[model samples]
Target: MRKLSMAVLVLFLLTSFGIAEAAGSYWQRMAHGYPNQLVVYEYVYEYVSPELEITARVPQLAGASDVNWQDEFNASIRQEVQDLVASLQEAALESLELEQVFQAFPYVGIMDFEVKLNRGGLLSLAIVTYTFTGGAHGMTYYDYINVDLTTGRRLAFTDLFDTEAEIARAAQVINEKIAQEPEWYFIDQFTPGLIAADQGFFLTESQAVICFGLYELAPYAAGIQEFPVSAP
Candidate 1:
């Protein structure tokens, strides 16, 4: 038993060292602007595995710039920022043309990410949260990406698990957790069976975290609900 334990430890150490070597180094880049009087944008983006170009296997993360994940990510952010700025400019111009005095036309958009896990030739997970100001309140949403370090491709749910069984298990766990705080969710909207393929999720060392976006299963006041299910 001691031998087995020692072997496992050695393997873990080796894996960690390899990932560190392969990933090289990364840096954060910030893009900010108040392109017009009405808009405010600040985004801090990450360049992971900067020295290695890996094509993102995941369809959502894949793009023409597949060979360079940083470029792909920056391009997406730039497009979003441009779109937001254009909208804000148009609104400001319309308000001017209409001879209306604007009280509050504040626009705020932020993008942040967390590296959840990286091991075993897998950049296990990254969760990017985008929060923007619009309507009565600011809204935040998440995007989950699991990548193969070797191929630089994003992974889908099927690539990570036995889809049906794991989803069922995870849903069961989430339902039980939510039941403990029933008032936090809309009973009708919060059904375990409703857990879908496209839901946002990431992994910890021993658990799978399933997340529901704001108002998906509850009121926005309840915020985002995450339930962690023990990994099999």
Candidate 2:
């Protein structure tokens, strides 16, 4: 990671100082954007100044059904997840990037993360845990994020970016990375046993678990999950 950062830093410095080799179309293309998956899209659009519109979608994969345990609860969760993804993606394009946001507001340390109110026909729940490695307020952070059943606006968002330019640049970087990754790539994994609902056939743990592995790949995704794990 250090090496990668140094390389990027050096490249940035050289480019900024007009010392690096003139990048060709390929290099420029490489810098354009990373590959993106529609697994679940969170799109945000700045309709006006204060009103940001959001939408979400779920990607249909060849083997998603096989891997995922589907039921009324999970189905509902999936829809909400899809909606949240679309809404957030729009927000990413509209809102500032996390880096810029964090730079703007350095006081809010990310203690946790979350996504809630996903519903298929029934309620669905999921949670993820994370440990911040770098950037932001302070300290190495670790916390869990969850997503569960709800009605209106299954997800909530709070970002720190300032301008659209920053968001575009950051998105470019992520798009590039995703482009270079493998298929399904297994961005995340679920916990051991399914957390079923109270009913005999369903599992509904008050808190759904977030696959830290997948959530971490969030940068690669469109926007951050709606809720922070530690929030009330």
Candidate 3:
């Protein structure tokens, strides 16, 4: 099979959400030649054959507040796509015997992203990818990318909290939500030590939404266990 050029890849997906042009809205910018409003264009890569199928939908950004940050972020996404391709390819090869036994089709792999929050001087995104190599179900992964527009710095969960106590309180809020439906989650696996300072999280106007991977704290039906806690 042949690989598609960047121009052809861009033709696959390109969209922009309306921005009110509000004052100090970092996510609202003239990106990718958009005179107004923030723009997000997806860079797609697909490879298909009788034995394997892999695709990655990476978000491409341009004309951000900081050129340096934009370059690094875009490069990072590309690298992630490359790594996924390589890893999935290896897994497909390793599972060749299992594939034949199960009479399965090509090993499938997919990667995509979502703009969870994009405003109020913060740009939060969720990168999601899935892979299935001869199994009853495919596995999913999540990566949260939060950017501080004013400084072009990557923000972590701790960065949003004023003090350690606030972070602990945020954890408490998440635990309380889990308590409501305790059976849906692996409550025992969720301990205080599990609250890593740089865990996956996105942001809203008033809440810092926590992110968890598939089967990390719950089953696949539970989806992503996101808890929104108060934060600036």
TM-scores for every predicted model: 0.60, 0.18, 0.76
Candidate 1 per-residue lDDT over residues 102-121, each given as its tens digit? 34443344444565655444
Top of the candidates by TM-score: 3
Greater-TM-score candidate between 1 and 3: 3
Between candidates 1 and 2, name the one with more favorable lDDT: 1
lDDT of 1: 0.52
Give the distance in Å from residue 134's predicted Cα in candidate 3 to where it truly belongs: 1.6
Enumerate clash totals for all models, in the order shown.
5, 44, 0
| Tens digits of per-residue lDDT for model 2, 95-173 | 4544444233222111122222222312222332222223542223222222111121222211211235533443343
Candidate 2 lDDT at 84 equals: 42
Ranking by TM-score: 3, 1, 2
Off by over 4 Å in 2: 1-70, 96-126, 129-232
lDDT of each: 0.52, 0.30, 0.71
Query: What would the per-residue lDDT of candidate 3 be over residues 22-141, giving only the tens digit for each residue?
Result: 332332231212332345679999998666788889897766766787788889899998888888777777777554632446778899999866655457788898887765888888
- The count of backbone overlaps in candidate 3 is 0
Error of 2 at 212 (Å): 18
